[model samples]
Target: MADRGSTELTNPLGALTLDQLRRRTSMKWRRFPPDVLPLWVAEMDVPLAEPVVRALTEAVALGDTGYPSGTRYADALAEFAAGRWGWRIDPDHTAIVPDVMLGVVEMLRLVTGAGDAVVVNPPVYPPFYQFIVHSGRRVVEAPLGEDGRLDPATLAPAFRDATTGGRPAAYLLCSPHNPTGTVHTRDELSAVAELAGRYGVRVIADEIHAPLVLPGAEFVPYLTVPGGENGLALLSASKAWNLAGLKAALAVAGPAAAADLARLPEEVSHGPSHLGIIAHSAALTEGGGWLTGLLSGLDANRLLLAELLAERLPAVRYRPPEGTYLAWLDCRRLGLGDDPAATFLEWGRVALNPGPEFGTGGAGHVRLNLATSPENVAEAVHRMVAALD
Candidate 1:
């Protein structure tokens, strides 16, 4: 029986012809053999949404290329957030920043002082650590418990302890946490909110990967929860629509947190590119169907990779991710003798994000981006098996 629910873009019926793929390859940076697939970066090889392309072309036609203002982009983002995540954000609460990571830094500056403590969950995004230190704040690592869940029951005490001596002004929460890709549940988020309320610590929830959440996954906006008003949220359509280079992202503040953002220089919202604004707005307003297709493609690729890894690399442990396009593979059992990212580069002729980049809990793992066409994912997996053999 045909798997009607399957939307694997690499399936022969759904894919471009070999000749078409060759043309796409010629357009990419690497001229590797067709068999060698590049899955390192989060970027997808899919074509841009028609709306995005139309928006870019229209902007060029009008010679409207210049510095961007916040009105349109903020409204589009606000509408998208309200429709998709059920969170109502005022356009005023939305600050257009360079990207998700930079948004984190700017928001951190609003809450913490130099040498003040900030809590982070390890086995998480590496940049969280860099952003805290770069802002002159001290990092207090609070590792997530096993079972691949964000259980606030286990984490609240660590956060409380960090604030006992002096308040830990901010907590960096990764919503569909990186590497592990755990979509934090509402119950868990509620506990976190309660904890923050008790300690008077601010929360910064990174929701960059929220739109790519697989079918059946529930995504609750952090600010919608009780006490969510005490924190801010950062998000971008870059991951969902594959527009990372566009430098389009928003930092959403609740009423209580808006004053803190007032400390930023007026220029934070000024220098953004016009094309970025167009692309972002287009994705939010008109790219919904395209995004739905992309999610379908990603779901098929993820299942294929999971099955392939289990059969070919049984020693490597990896539970299926709850959301996002990345797969966290535990390579310690394989004893690849080096970081899996490096090992895969040399042995499999493929590139992957090293586990170390996601913090200590990721030390023995490697993050595989399964966001591309399924054929490419299979090629990379096959190469890995052959290399290990």
Candidate 2:
């Protein structure tokens, strides 16, 4: 059952019409043909929070569209952290980046040399493969457990193999991991911290989805564990607040690794959009109530998604995601061949992220974005069933 009380309590996050969204020029709508319903990409279909819009509007009005720099973004994130999560972020130990992946790539350069391995848990966010490979490093796969959780049995060997032959390596971690939407517990993260310390491998955590954790689950910041003092984390308001277009993220350093973070090239700060910093800062500082409302709506949608799937496409096995709006559907049983996304797009005219692109265990799956309205969710399932038929 949907949380009717909670759903009504929050400001509605999505009420999008197909025509209204079609008018936009972003990748989500543009990548597909006019006939296709796009459920691909991490993009959300919601109105901007008033604070974010007001901040960006004020910046434009003041002609403040110059280069971005300063402590305001960091301070806002720090405040958001203290309130949302219990961690105390030091603004001095943070740097602003154009986005999360760029920050991870830069952090990789700081820690690893060319051809050294970078570890990732697959099936993961697809960019983890590209960014690490393009940066002249090999991607070492530490695929998640069949249960869709991180297993130390897999990590222990992967960490050993990754750091073998005196190679400098780093673990590129995805907290509240993408695709699967698994919110890693503190114990799991503590185990990872211990493993990283034992293997002398640096950890770079992409916590972009930190703020989207659904009810009954908790999101643990990677650097908060005991052995995580030397780890680096990337934080952003882009995911929670739907500000990807004009948003930047912060790279935070654990206490022991402050000097290493300072070594990040000063030029990196110049990549942020001037309006991005202002918008992101406003989201963190003044958008708390709006965020609370957004979470409520997303929570309702998660349940609504399950009910629709059960009624329309019961054979499709779906483990309801704990965090993020993305749902990883095990489509192997649907008999639509190895790549289910291709079939869905061709037959149903509903586009989704191809599972194989996420690597390893991703071959028979597709990731569905649930950030749209409940009507879209039901329509997507209807289209999917029609495709399978």
Candidate 3:
């Protein structure tokens, strides 16, 4: 609805004008009008970069839709990782996977077997738990403390207790944590790696949202931390570039962890989409500038949301999001603790991510996507306040 250059609105969530938002809404699913905003999904309404679009177009014109044969896709990804993250991953240690979730499953398969325990920090990505269950491993909960941080004192006890009889095989680490939006500091991850390593557990870092950190905040790649590469880092430009359909993501194996990447079955490797490879290559190599602009836009939206909430919905507590477009709203004070997400859908007419999906600590919260136009954000916040009031 709002163009990239729209002025900052003084009102809370300075969002798009209704008419402008309507035009954008019409381009996608028509289930709702432009006036009825959708902020629930991770996707942004912004258009793709020209290079990404051109790369996919050129690949399709070549007309070779057949299965990808070998490690070319992997090599491209490896190069991208080296240049972008300052992490040196041997193309040999990197695997091109269909999605981050699939990568997680494969990593689980590599290190653990049925009945082994895996730790996850709650109020995290919902799929983290699903992957543990789907893999037939015991889902061990190490929910974050109220400040949205993983508490080592509590976690150490949980790990010891879970492994007292048998060892936990893995830990799902969400760097730049979802829903809560707190980027795991180097010291924080180092503590986790030390604890997990000491207990014979492997760490799987879900870093798909790495590129979306707000200004003045830095995201520490899990593998870069001390003993971090002792684990696996799952990453993709899909989340940062809004290219989920591309189906490309990387599983970077630590020096000690490279064997896990290779141990993945051939069938899994063959399932990667060809277009996904092309789009990913383009996004990583050519999408940096575009991504910078997107992050700038998201930062503006974050400030707008905070300002709006303070003025209108003062009861709602929102910490400044450090990374990712997702904003975590603490709504416990309103007594709408049981289902904040559904309440928003019913009363505010805006679709936002339900906090409960994140895990035990998320019941009184909701996750909002601030990656859209300022106008859309403003309108969504306005409606939410109206509904709450």
Candidate 4:
């Protein structure tokens, strides 16, 4: 279902209409009432890539449903990395987990202990705070710069504070960071690797959005940087291919951190579904063309959101994200206190993610999902504008 030319690609976001999407029973569709336009979570509105659907259907038809085995997922990811970003991944250095967040927690456990501090750059994915705290570790914040990029000056102090009293600590980094959609540059990540090295803090990068870097931006795999040889990264095709319902992700370790990753409990590998592995492998290996189309669609949606906000909700400040289908909107000018998402849902009949939950810099903001039709994106803005009246 794609139109391709030498330089043009079909916009996947335009494929489905609002009525078609409403038939979905996923959390993004079901969490709000029928009248509300739900644009809150990370879920995408696109259909599965032909390759992934075919692979899954074949597996089911062949009665291949059993526990996961072999290194197909890792191998496919290695191939995707090499082809997409010119990065190399040693399958021997990877581990499978249920999803990105769980893998982050597991990697944290590998290097840090209970009550130890785990530093994060906020307004980040809210689950980064929850999973860290729930795993018995304390959360530390190093808020991003005013420009929505990582600030080394801010991180240094947080690193020092986290390692106080000789306490072991880990830094949970969201590469191509969430909510804000600021794609961290190679220079920025190299600085982070250098800083983490100086402070003896282990880095666990959540790189789930690595594959979705839109036009005009580059995604640097965390482990590929010079001093990042000691860091661990979590990667998945779930976000780019809309396979969140089929859970699976990879925990890859840098050369220097390989031994540490090997220490993970064998039982941890049991968490991912066999079908999830099959689906993820197929997507990474054969869904490249489909992903290219999705990225094109997302690129268009980001711009459309910018235009809609400029015309209708001029008070809202938004920087089209460099990566991910998520948009972080600064709504403080609308006079909606700390949480504008609540007001939007109640008054606008639209469901967006509450900003306060993202920690630190989240106040007076809201996170909107932009992976839907242009019509929905425009309508969501229209509804939000109506809320203000």
The candidate maximizing lDDT is 4
Candidate 1 local lDDT, residue 189? 89
Pairs clashing within candidate 3: 12-308, 13-378, 15-374, 15-375, 15-378, 16-375, 16-376, 22-34
**For candidate 4, which ten residues in a row score worst on lDDT?**
1-10
- lDDT agreement with native, every candidate: 0.77, 0.88, 0.77, 0.91
Model 1 TM-score (2 dp): 0.90
> Cα RMSD (Å) per model?
4.5, 3.3, 4.8, 2.4
The lDDT ranking, best first, is 4, 2, 1, 3
lDDT of 1 by residue, 1-389 (tens): 11112232322212444456456533232545555556665666677777888889998999988888647878877777778777787887778888888888888878877787788888887878888898898877778887777767556766776676775578889998887878888898888898888877889999999887887778888988999986899988888877887877888888888887667677777645668878988888877777777777877877888889888888888877778888888899888754877777777888778888877577778888877677777888888887777
Residue 307 of model 2, lDDT score: 89
2 against 3, candidate with superior TM-score:
2
Model 1 whole-model lDDT (C-alpha atoms):
0.77
Off by over 4 Å in 2: 1-9
| Per-prediction TM-score | 0.90, 0.96, 0.90, 0.97
Question: Which tens-of-lDDT digit does each residue in 287-322 have in candidate 2?
Answer: 777777777877887888788888888888898889
C-alpha positional error of residue 266 in candidate 3 after TM-score superposition, expressed in Å: 1.1
- Candidate 3 residue-wise lDDT, 330-369, digit = tens: 8888788667877777788887888888888888888888
lDDT tens digits, residues 118-172, model 4? 9999999999988998999999999999999999999999999999988899999
